[model samples]
Target: MSKVISRDGTIIEYDRTGDGPPIILVMGAFNDRSTGAPLAGQLEPDFTVINYDRRGKGESGDTLPYAIEREIEDLNALIAEVGGSAFVFGYSSGAVLALHAAVKGVPLSGLVLYDPPVEGYDGRLVHQLTELISAGRRGDAVEFFQSQLVGMPEQVVVQLRNAPFRPYLEAIAHTTVYDTKIVCEPPKQEELAGISVPVLVVAAEEMRDKFKQAAELLVSVLPKGQHLCLEGQSHHIVAPVLAPVVKKFLLS
Candidate 1:
């Protein structure tokens, strides 16, 4: 494990592997660096992969009165550690965060986003999650995210009530507020248009239609954007199938 201090003095922990061009993995909610370990392992043979814990989770440090810019700064710190530029791969809501960072002019060589949830986040979700977490109902917060926000059925939520990962989800439930705030107010199309770097928005064949539609729309809006839908894939990462596509794009 390695660390870099962000602009606001927060220590961000990361694992670095391989020895070539740099690529940083930015994960979504319900994830720490561990969620990205498999993909990192696959990419490390050809690219130097940096997998890190976003603030407020894993071994990273967090600051109170969180602002979205702080998260951008966290990513900027990582890019700086990699010599001021790197390719970035963001999954789920982390993809949204990456787009926002690119808009704000963080140095990036290219971007790859997988199955970004470009729609369906509630405008009032930040307030609701804050209330639940502040009231010490972390379990409820987790369930609210699973059922209401992510649209999991109640039966599925109930079935996973005692899941071994339930506690892990609840442990970082507070950061769900961070992710909700990020996706709830997505980047403007005009802002997206201003990004001058190459971007690839990827979707899975078996995922919801909305995901494919969102990828196509994002591609249309981005000046250098392209879209690809993988066969027999879903929202989850299948690193063996994905790593080659990412490698091709980054190398191109």
Candidate 2:
């Protein structure tokens, strides 16, 4: 694993693979570098993939008081390690961070986002999550996050509960608060207008209208942007379909 120290003195750990322009994979909640392995493996041949554990999970350091800017700094540090500029692909909450980074003027060649959760769409969803967090029920918080925030079906949630990664998901479930902070506001069309980098907003076929709207909103705001929907796919199938799209956009 390669390591880079962020400006705030946190040690970030990452796995580097393939041989081309660096593409950093920023994971969403409930995912680490390992969780994205399958998708990363597929893109390894075309781009130098940098898959890293976000702070507070896996091999990265987590100091007190988690702020969204620090996570942005982590991305910057990773980009610096990989030769100053890169194409970035982010999923869910990580996508939110990537958008914020791009708006803040990080030197990115391109960006691809998959279903980033932004506030103001379905206020009831946020209310339910806040209630769960208030009750101090971490498991319920995780479930609400998957079902409500991620819009996963009941059957999918049940299957995941029985899956091997259940423990890992449970462990980082509390980090939803961090995700909430980063996505507290919906994507601003004006903010995205300043980003000159190419962007691709992807959505799953089964994603709700709100998600599709969010993707469309991003496409509208970005100076050079396009939108694609993965046919016959849902939130769970995002990584596999997304890898190819990211490869094509970044490598083209």
Candidate 3:
């Protein structure tokens, strides 16, 4: 494990592998660097892959009074550590954070996003989460988010809550609100108009309509962008199919 101090003095942890132009994998909620491992392994041969734990999870540090910009800074710090600029690939809400960073001008060579969970997150969800965490019902907080926010059926949530994953979900439950907070207020289309870097927005054909629409809408707003939908794929991209799409885009 390696570490880089962010602008706010928070230590961000990351693991690096492979060789070539740097690429950082930004993770979404309820996940740390581990979530990026599989995809990272696939990309390692063609690119140097750096997968890190986002603040407050895994081995990374967090600061008080978190701001979305702070997370953006965290990503920038990684970019700086990897020789100033590199390509980036974000998954789920991580894709949203990547765009936020790009709009703020993180030195990126190219950008690829895999089915960002763009729609459905709103201010009200943040409010509910804040209230839940404030009340100290962190477990219920996770349940509510999985069921209501992610649109999982209540029955499925109940089953999973009692399973082994519950502890992991609850362990990082507070960060759920943090994820909600960052993506809650999306940037106006005009804000993203200035992002001239090449971007590839991806969607899985079997994924939910909301995310598919989000991917399509996202591509529409970017000045230099393209779209691809993988056949026989779902929310969790099949790395074999996804990696090549990314490799082709960045290499071109």
Tell me the whole-model lDDT of each prediction, alpha carbons only: 0.92, 0.80, 0.86
**After superposing candidate 3, which stretches have Cα over 4 Å from the reference?**
none
The per-residue C-alpha lDDT of model 2 at residue 219 equals 85
- Note the residue pairs that clash in candidate 2: none
Which 10 consecutive residues of model 2 have the lowest summed lDDT? 118-127
Off by over 4 Å in 2: 119-136, 152-163, 237-240
Residue runs of model 1 more than 4 Å from their true location after superposition: none
Each prediction's TM-score versus the true structure: 0.98, 0.87, 0.96
Q: How many clashes show up per model? A: 0, 0, 0
lDDT of 3 at 44: 98
The TM-score ranking, best first, is 1, 3, 2
Per-residue C-alpha lDDT of model 3 across residues 12-54, encoded as one tens digit per residue: 9999999999999988888898888988989999999999999
Q: What is the lDDT of residue 20 in candidate 1?
A: 92
Candidate 3, overall lDDT?
0.86
Candidate 2 lDDT by residue in tens digits, 55-98: 97888887657777888899999999889999998887888889
